[model samples]
Target chain A: MVLASGSMALATRTERTPSLIGSVWRSTVGKKAVMAVTGVIMLAYLVAHMLGNLKVFFGAGEFNHYGAWIRTIGEPFLHHKWFLWIARVVLGSAVVLHGVAAFQLSRRDLAARPAKYAHARRRASYATRTMRWGGVILALFIVWHILDLTTLTVNPNAEEGRPYENLVASFDRPPVTALYIVAMLALGLHIRHGFWSAAQTLGANSPRRDRLFKVLANALALLLTCGFIAVPVGVMTGVVS
Target chain B: MNLTLRIWRQRTADAAGAMTSYEVSGISEDMSFLEMLDHLNEELILAGDEPVAFDHDCREGICGACGMVINGQAHGPERTTTCQLHMRHFADGDTVDVEPWRAAAFPVVKDLVVDRSAFDRVIGSGGYVSVPTGSAPEAHATPVPKPVADLAFEHAECIGCGACVAACPNGSAMLFTSAKVVHLNALPQGAPERESRVLGMVGAMDAEGFGGCTNTGECATACPKGIPLQSIATMNREFLRASLRGGRGA
Candidate 1:
């Protein structure tokens, strides 16, 4: 009896160790951690992208050169535009993972509360309510942004090298500028709640750090929104021309 | 005080439920919410009507046996259990909406009563330490530090009334599960089973069809015991640690 029980215990231990990653992806908390990590990854990329977009304030020569420099990063060891491709792949993976986790979680959320309250009162904050819809807005924006800028497929000018001119061409249209502004605003709201939520999911938040994280989240949302919107505003006002 | 209460009424679990309105009068401000319900029930029985069905054991707040969403707020707007929510919080001639805890894991058993066995199953998974029961052990022998003991006590305040789940927009029970996990995992006596406790409890929680937490703070805000939202964060830390460092065999 002792030998059989011992073997059973051994089998259970072996069964658990091999499926660590699988288990993490399967559990709700674990899937949230995946979403949190990917969110942080995307947040970091957005910060860099926003900073790069701000180079337009320095005029066409510097802005175009900055665009070219992104392609030539890690030139000695990496091929032309290889760094850009690598960054795209990493960012693409993060977006996909974050989106998938969010979709699954949202589906589960809706399912859990099958019955609606008779007297419905607005419970969470507006930023919290907007997370799912804001994420969708951001996703659609990313697609359109890539088409307009990266491939130049939807760019009014479709210029390959002159990013400054291409940006000006795109945002020069009133409708395009309005769409960009709305998407950037949605992005701001998403980050306002999302950054602090990511901190909580990743187990980094505490009573002491809660206020700090909230302040940081708000600051990031405001900073990124203003920075991204500045380029379109600069183009429309003839400041970057 | 005269009040119009629109309480959820279902004859059975499988029956179609709807808001059934009842006019109740002469309710004292000092009467607890449940006592007001009791008065309504007394009137209903006198009129030969089926009274409202709700779950309540101890009329005091600590029992965790009583819970209902009053006017869309869990327990009530007063941040106490339904048993302790006095009628004074409601204005005279007000229309009060009463409902049960609504979650897939916590299905309505009857009017204003939900089956909360999901919580019991979650606790049964690994909410206890393996203590031998021959003789009473000396308290000082375990040597749990004061801060750790305080932390454990704070989480131990969870009454499993299912308010967190009811208040959560997503119907997430992360707060309740986290309270149980953190309560036991903090003490020295619970050290040996800490890793398994988190894993088992989390697995049970997921299997119970509860939603995932989105960190909206709804659960924390509605919690009557004042369980902090940081408990979920603490549990996340413990779950990550347990997942990284594999638990002992089942």
Candidate 2:
């Protein structure tokens, strides 16, 4: 018995160890973990971005200064606008990873059940069902957002380095404001489900704590939605102008 | 009462399957779903046609042997097993479409029957205690807290039916695996093998081609035994702990 057990141990030790990271990426559970981590990273950025947008309420002087401050972050140690570039890199990577994981998992799910159900009924919520479409809308919105605000390419009245003028110009148009509002609604729904899902996937949910997590998820979704829409509403209502 | 049935017919696993409609008369409202199918099968046999095949045992909903997607819902429109669903849920002149559990891992064996041995393999990986055959131990030898015992029992109610897989859009098996893991790991006797059990079972689940849980909560809703969605969350916690402890080098 001892000899057999020793041989088993020796065999295990001699076997080529699989790459841990590669295995995790391949497994469904591992992909879920990746989604949860990347989702949390994006959620954190949203909160920070929302807070930064709130600076507009303080007037153009403070708002534009805030934008300039972001560029000058880590000054003396870092070159001009280096911090902003670094943030873009980090946020960009997180977005790509989150999107890739979601897309691959969705494909796997579809492949798992090739045949369509004849009388399928939904047992999940509206937000859960619309997650895939909401994600697509948000992705498209991000591109339009960057083009309108950062690049000044889509903004009809493009102003160089004038953050407040650019902001007002973008939201001044009814079509642009309408599109932003719609995208924010999708973002709200996405966050509503994604927040709680991230908690479940990351192993933070418990029977006792489930209610608390749900409440927190709703509050975060509401806050981010209102926060983002407040800026466009402010411009449309002439509050910020 | 008369009912129209659109049942999927297939000869073998590799054979193509399609919906074939049939009409049945004099199916009593009191008859269970399977009994109604039996009536249909009896008619088919008398007409010199192959009887429709389906899986069932105990006819009482305990064995988890009966499963099918009825009218786009797993186990019909009711929140119970197909065996427990009675024909009274349907109205006269109603048409019902029945198909086997549609999943890549669960291929149709014939008509309404699909292979469910994937679940067995998952359980085989690590779903039981390693107790040897011997005399039973004293009842009071291992005291269990009432709340813990109740939670474990609630999870233990899972019948290993493939409804969760059928109801899920992604055909994920998280709910089934979670039920098994939580039932055993929550018990004192199952403590020693907790980490290994979770790691092995999760590995087996992925190997079976099941999708990851997106927290859609459909599995819990479609579950006949009323297994709560919290079980999946609990299992996630267990898996995270096991992985952190270097199980399977995860």
TM-score of each: 0.97, 0.93
> Candidate 1: deviation at residue A69, Å?
1.1
Evaluate candidate 2 and give its CAPRI docking class based on DockQ. medium
Alpha-carbon RMSD, each predicted model: 1.9, 2.7
- Put down candidate 2 lDDT per residue, A25-78, tens digits, no spaces: 777877888888888998999999998999999999999889888889999899
Off by over 4 Å in 1: A1-18, B248-250
Residues B1-250, candidate 1: write the lDDT tens digits. Answer: 9999999999899999999999999999999999999999999999999999999998888989999999999998998999999999989999999999999999989898899999999999889899888989987788988999899999999999999999998888899999988898888888888988888888899999999999989999999999999889989988888888866532
Which candidate leads in lDDT?
Answer: 1
lDDT of each residue in B96-197, candidate 2, tens digit only: 999999888898899899999999999998898888789999999999999989989998899988999998888899999999999999999888879778
The DockQ values of the predictions, listed in order, are: 0.76, 0.63
Q: First chain TM-score in every candidate?
A: 0.94, 0.93
